[model samples]
Target: MPNDHYEAEQSVISGPKGKVRADSIQFFKFDGKSEVDPQKLAKDLEQLRAAVRQVPDVDPDERDRAVAALLAAQDAATEGDEVKVRANLKRVGKWVLNVAESIGVGVAIAVLRQVVASG
Candidate 1:
């Protein structure tokens, strides 16, 4: 299909053993910068509305329970990620402090040796 500013094309792909499949993919690329297309936006909204309507309906209490379960699961996942991040940070911090302290002690010892030799 061809329009004033947008064009669409299709292609067919053949799988292994000569199985052919037709793909109905539409590519809408603008030739130049343009304003929003109201028609396309309306069509997209309608499609979304239809999809939402297809979802199963639950009673209010059941819906609340489902929402609570989802929130609990999300909180658990977040906490798990946070725990892992903190553990890794703590491990890295410990290694860094160890390295820093070793360097500090070496520098102190070298300074003391220099002072004693000068005296």
Candidate 2:
């Protein structure tokens, strides 16, 4: 009798991560986060979606327009949207610094309160 208990799985080379295991790979995917694979076009679209989701009662037409604009921006990026990309990078850097500063201040306040309670 032939053994039928074991099945062999195959591997495929897809991206930089070579030899992708069949059981460990996903084909269709959508990450809701803004910064997925930074080089991926889908990441830009996801960022646009996240920004659109923030507005109160956003109109369908407006959302469509935004998506169109994002596509154009992606094209421009492909054609070297250097100025816009640099500006955005700078803005994000500043925003991150501000957030870190706020969190540091909050932590300092909590620590001071704890010290006061102890003393």
Top-lDDT structure, candidate number? 2
lDDT of 1 by residue, 33-106 (tens): 32323233233323332332333554545434433432332243234332222222222212222332444433
For model 2, the stretches where C-alpha displacement exceeds 4 angstroms are: 1-42, 50-56, 83-119
Q: How far is candidate 1 from the true structure (C-alpha RMSD, Å)?
A: 30.5
Candidate 2 RMSD to the correct structure: 19.0
Task: Give all TM-scores, in the order shown.
Answer: 0.22, 0.28
lDDT of 2 by residue, 1-119 (tens): 24434332322343343453333432211234422232343344345435544545546665556545445534534444433332333322222223324444332122223222322
Q: What global local distance difference test value does model 2 have?
A: 0.37
Q: All models: lDDT?
A: 0.31, 0.37
